[model samples]
Target: MSPRTEQQYEEIREEKKKLIMDTALQLFANEGYHNTSIDQIARTAGISKGLIYNYFTSKEQLLQSLIFSGFDEFAQFFDPNRDGVIEKEELHYLLREMFKLLKEKMSVWKLYFGIMLQPQVMKMVEKEVYQYALPYLKLLVDYFKKEGKENPYLEARFLSAVGDGIGMHYITDPDNFPLEECVEKLIALYQ
Candidate 1:
């Protein structure tokens, strides 16, 4: 066959990059970012360090890429302009979607929560992650306020803390945790 086209090359490159990121996410999440090295990532991913460098200049950039890519998947559900105002059904939909993501994309969220506790990684990624998260947080606060919850911002923060707790529990003990039932109860609590 003739040589692959440019688009095909790019697609292959993206696939390799994703493999590297996924491996690094697991390594960083479990081993800690500072403890992990590019050599470890390359070995885990079954690729050479040079190949990883071709896609990511450094481990910091690789971690940043993983963080954004993980959050980006869930961000689409939080677009406020999509329907102008949030509704109860929309809130339920959002909860279901978030739970689904927590279950289905556990690695991404694991890496996220793991890195959040790391001072070094948090320093590098804090601002961008807050920017990524603010819209969803604001929507939650606004929804609580519209629903007549007292101290809507604090309520929103509590709701977020609950979600984070559930995520941590589910990730830590997924098979034993009643994830779906817990999410249903959480939805009811918010309503």
Candidate 2:
């Protein structure tokens, strides 16, 4: 076989990193983050424990990475145009896409809410979470204001809480959560 090029090596690295993260996310979601050990993740991924360290400095870092990856995925649906404004159509689009993502990546969202419910685990990444969310929060507030909501900030927060509740409930009972109906209602409310 020809010697692997730098690009090939990079691809291998990314694949392995994703494998580790995927394994960790599953274990964390099903087994609970604190109960899962690095050894378990390594065994599950079929990689040596040391290999995980090469990709992530620690298990905590791995958890943070998983959380951040989910955040990044969700961010794409929020402001696709990068125009710093969300039109009514854009708001509906965001709601539809967000629910689609939740359905498609159920395990990832389960892990996210699971982590958020655990105080100790959340503390490890709370600052970063707020940093990541602040801009989006501002955007929501701006959108609500533009929509002529009397209390835009409160409206934004209420919407956020509603999203969180929907995610929590859907993950808890995905088989009968009426997810599509809920998304439709949310879109209507925002409109």
Residue 71, model 2: lDDT of 87
Name the weakest run of 10 consecutive residues (lDDT summed) in model 2.
74-83
Instruction: For model 2, state the Cα shift of residue 103 in Å.
Output: 0.8
* Number of colliding residue pairs in each model: 0, 0
Clashes of 1: 0
Candidate 2: where are CA atoms >4 Å away? 1-4
lDDT of 1 by residue, 1-191 (tens): 74998899999998998899889988887787888989999999999989998999888899899889877767765665465458888888888888897888888888888888888879999999889878777888888888888898998899899999999999888899999999999999866
Model 2 lDDT per residue over 93-175, tens place? 87788889889998889998898888998899899889878887898899989989899999989998999899899999999
Pick the TM-score winner: 2
Candidate 2 TM-score, true structure as reference: 0.91
Clashing pairs in 1: none
Provide the TM-score for each candidate, comma-separated.
Answer: 0.89, 0.91
